[model samples]
Target: MLLLNSGCGTKNKNSFESDIIIYGGTSAAITAAVQAKKMGKSVLVVSPDFHLGGLSSGGLGFTDTGDKSVIGGLAREFYHRIYLHYQKEDSWKWQKKEEYGNIGQGTPAIDGDERTMWIFEPHAAEQVFEDFIREYDIQVYRGEWLDRENGVSKSNGTIISIKTLSGKAFKGKMFIDATYEGDLMAAAGVSYHVGRESNDTYGEKWNGVQFGVFQHGHYFRDSISPFVIPGDPTSGLLPEISEEPIAPNGTADSKLQAYNFRMCLSKHPDNRLPFPKPENYDPSRYELLARVYASGWDETFDKFDPIPNLKTDTNNHGPFSTDYIGKNYAYPEASYEERKAIIKDHEDYQMGLMYFLANDPKVPEKVRQRISEYGLAKDEFIDNGHWPHQIYVRESRRMIGDYVMTEHDVLGDKTVPNPIGMGSYHLDSHNVQRLIGPNGYVQNEGDIGVKPKEPYSISYGTILPKKQECENLLVPVCVSSSHTAFGSIRMEPVFMILGQSSATAAVLAIDAKIAVQDLDYEKLKHRLKEDAQVMLLSERLK
Candidate 1:
C-alpha cells in the first residue's frame, strides 16, 4: 500500500519549496535547520509553538545527559556557546559567579577546557537557539500548527507538501520530523508505537507494565489505605486512585508514562512568583500528599536542582510529586484543544500541589516552611505567568522503521551498525498510573530504570522509515525505536545529536541524488565524523 521514495524534482520554483522542511520548533528542529544550512541546503522550520527549543529552552535546565564525550558536533557546540555566554561577568546578574556554585548530574556544570556548559537557564538556552537561527539565516514559521486532518499531501510515499493551520503551504525535497510528538511523521503516514510494549516484543528486560519494580522512591513508602476513610473499602477509593485491575507484569498495554513540567523555582525574594491558587484549584486533590507527609517520607526539596542565577530546575521526586500519573494517556493522540485541556488540568494539579504544600494546615510545619520558601522564578518565562511554557514530554510516539532500537541495544548486548549518534542515559520511564496495590494501598506503577553499562550507538536506520513507507523523510527526535530503547534515546542531547545527524544524512541524500535509505553509509559516516560527531567509544569507556 506504500511506495518508496519518488525521485522527482520540485514541480515548481517557489520560496516555499525548500531543500528540506523540518517540523517542530524543538532543540532538534533548530539543530537540524542549522546543519542543513551549513551543508548549503535551504531549509525552513515549521513550528507549532511560538518558542523554539522544546525542553532545552523550557524549564528543564538540569540536563539529563549521560556521557559528555558521546555528545559532539552542533550539540556540543550549542553547549560551548552556553559556556561562552556565562564567561562574561554580566551573565550573572541575579547571582554572583561564586555565589551560585556549579552543579550537575555527577559532573561540574561548567567544563572550562572542553568549553561546554551543561546546566543553564531557560532563557539562555532560547538565546542560543535564536542565535543559531539568526546566524544561519534560517527561515522559521513559528506558532503554525499543522493541519493534521488534511494538510499533508503525499505522493507515492513521499510527502509533497505540508499545509499549516494558517493556510500556509511548504514544499521540500527532504523532510525531518523534529517534533516531540512526531506529528509530521504521523501525518505523513509513518508507523509509530505509542506506549510500552511487552518484554517479549523485543526480548527486553525493562519494557512492560512493572508493578513491583521500583527504581526511585516514587512508590508509596508505607502502606496507606486507598479508601477515602481509613480502613473501609466500602467508603470507596480516593480521587485519582484507579480502580482498574493492574495489568499482568510484562504484558503489553497502551498506557503511557507520566509527564510533568520541569519547573524553574527561585528562593530569591525579588525573583519569586507565588504559586497562585489556580482557578478551580481543589485542595482535596492533594490529600494523598498529605498522607505521604503523614507517612514520614518528607524529601520534597531533594530535586530542586540548581541552574544559574539562584534558580532551580525542579523535577518530579518522591511519591505523589509533580508527575500527574495517568492524566496524559490521551495526549499523544488528542486534538489540539483536547491537549490544551489536558495541559491545563496538569497545570492546575501541580500549582494546587504547590499551594497545598505551602498553605495547608494538614502539612507538617517544617515541611510547609521549607516548601514555602521557593516559588516560580520571576524573570523566567514571564509571558507564561512565570510557569514553564513546555511540559517534560518524556516519551511519545516512536517510529517503527527498518530497525527498532531495543533494550538489547540500550544494554549494549546487540551491535548497531551505521551509528549516527549515541545515547548513554538510563532506561528511564516515569510512573504510568496510580493504582491500588495488591495490598489495597495506593501505589504508582510503570516507573522503571535500568542504566546502561556504557553509551551505545544509535543507528541511522532508527531515523529512517521503511523503504516502502517513505524515503525522503527522517525522524530524529522521535526516531524508530521500541519503548525499551526510547527510554534512553529520548533524551534532549541525543535528540540534538540525532537531529544534526539526520539533517546531515538528508544533505548527503540530496547530494548523491538518491533516496535517503539508498545513500552510501560510508559517505554519511565520514561527513558526520568531519562534523565532530562522536561515533565510537574511546578506549577508557570500553
Candidate 2:
C-alpha cells in the first residue's frame, strides 16, 4: 500500500510517513529504497514478501544479464558485492572457488577487471540485498498486502494515503510502485494491460499470438496426440493440453506466458535433498511429457546453468518442462488467495514432474539415472521446504503510462524519450499455450527470440503515469511497454536500473514540489549520470 500526495497531516503523528513510499519486496524495490535514502529522502518499503530479494535472492541466481557493460548504478554494485563475498576463502562450502570455472552467458562469470560476479548462490544474493537495507537504515514492513479493493485514498488526482490488509496506513509525498505485479499502481485507479495486445495495435511483428514461430526447442517435434487415449479423441483430452482451437497469428488474446520455479539444485552428496513427492501426485498429468521423451528429446539438462559452489539454477528447457504453460493467465487480476492456489499448483506440478523423471518406471532409465544424481540445495530456502519462495513471473500487468514502449523502441527503430536506462537483451518470450496444432500433433506456441538491433535507452515516461490519472506515482517493475518490447526490458538488471531511476525521480519530484510527470528531464538525466547509471552505450565505453 502507498500514498502519493502528502501536503495534509496524518491522523496520528506516530504513523509511518516518508518522502517516498515503495511497495513490493522485489530486487527493484530494494534498489529503489536504497536510492531514495541515498538521495537524503526518507523511504519506506511496504513488502508483501517475507524475504528481501524477490527472484534474485529466491532461486534465480544465474543472472539474465544481457549486456554487462550497460548494467550500471546499484545493479552493478550488487554484482560487485557478490564478487567481494566470493573473494573470501570461507565463502565456499561445497566446492572450492577455483573449481567453479569462469563461465557465463558469453563473458566470464567472475570478471576481475570489473570487480563483479554475474553468477552466485541464492543466499549470497539475499545477503547482499540485506546488507544494502541495513547500511541505508531503510524502514521496511514485511507481509503487508495492499487492500486492492479499497486501499487507495486519492484527493485531486493524487493519492493521500494507502492502507494495507492489516489496516496499517502509510503517507508519502511521492510513491514508487516497484512491484512485479504493479498492484499498488492498479489499486490507485491507474490503467494497466493484462495480456498481449494485437500486433496491429502497436505495429509490432511479434506482439500477439505466435503460433508457428518456435525459436526454442520447447515445441513438439513428434506427432503426439492430446487425447487420453492415443489417437482416440473420444477418450477426452490429456491433462495440461488446451482444448481450444489455436487462434490466428498476430491476433490479440488474454493468454499469458508460462511461469515456473528456478530450482537451485546441488549434486554434492553432503548438501543435497532428494526430490520430495508432493501431495496428490498424479502421473497422468505428465502424459504429454512422456510422449515428448519418447520422441527422442533428451535435452532435459540443457538449462541447468551452474553457479558457485557446485549448484545449478535449473530452468525450463525442453517441451513439457517446468513451465506450467497456460495456467497463469488469470494471475495478473486474480485475488491473493487465488494467486496462492496457482502458485501451489505450479509447485505440485513441478515437484511431480521431477519425481516422475527421477523414479517412475515409465521414464527412460538413462534419464532417471542422470537426474537422480542432483537434488535440491540443502542450505538454500531452508524455511520453505528447500523450495524457492518466489515464482518466475516472466510477464504481468503492464501500466499504460505517459508513453508505452513498443518493439520499435527495443530495435532502435524509434527514438526513446527521456532516457533513464538501457537494456540489450534479445526479445525473449516463453511458451504461452500448449494445444493441438493443425497437423493433429500437440505443439507449443508463443516462444519467440529475436535479437535487438542494439542496446537502446529506456524512457522515463514508461514509468510515469498519465498526469491526469495520478500525479506522484512511479512504476519500475511492471513498466509501460508492449508485449514484445517488455520481453527485452523485463530482466532483473533492467528492473534494478529502473528502480534506481524511479527513486531518483521521486526524490527530485519531492524537492521540486511537482508531479512526477512534470519533472525536468535534464535534471533527472544529470542525477542519473551522477549516480553512475549508464543511459548511453558510449558512456560505458568511456
Question: Which numbered prediction scores highest in TM-score against the true structure?
Answer: 2
| lDDT (10s digit) by residue, model 1, range 1-542 | 22224332344443266788999999999999999999988888999988899999999889997988788889989999999999989999788998878888866899887888999999999999999999999988889888999988888777878988888888888889999888888888989988889989888778888999999788898998888897899998887788889988888888888999999998888889788898888888888888888889878889999999989999999888999999898888989999999999999888888998889998999988888788899889999999899988888788999788998998989899989888899988889989988898888998988999988998999999998888789999888887878888988988899999999999888887678989899999999988988877851121
The local distance difference test score of each candidate is 0.87, 0.90
Q: Candidate 2: global Cα-lDDT?
A: 0.90
Task: Give lDDT tens digits, candidate 2, residues 61-109.
Answer: 8888888899999999999999999999999999998899878877789
Model 2 per-residue lDDT at 156 = 83
Clashing pairs in 1: none
lDDT, model 1, position 165: 85
Residue 115 displacement (Å), model 1: 1.4
lDDT of model 2, residue 314: 94
- Model 1 vs. true fold: TM: 0.96
The best candidate in terms of lDDT: 2
Model 1 C-alpha RMSD vs. true structure (Å) is 2.6
Runs in model 2 deviating more than 4 A are 1-14
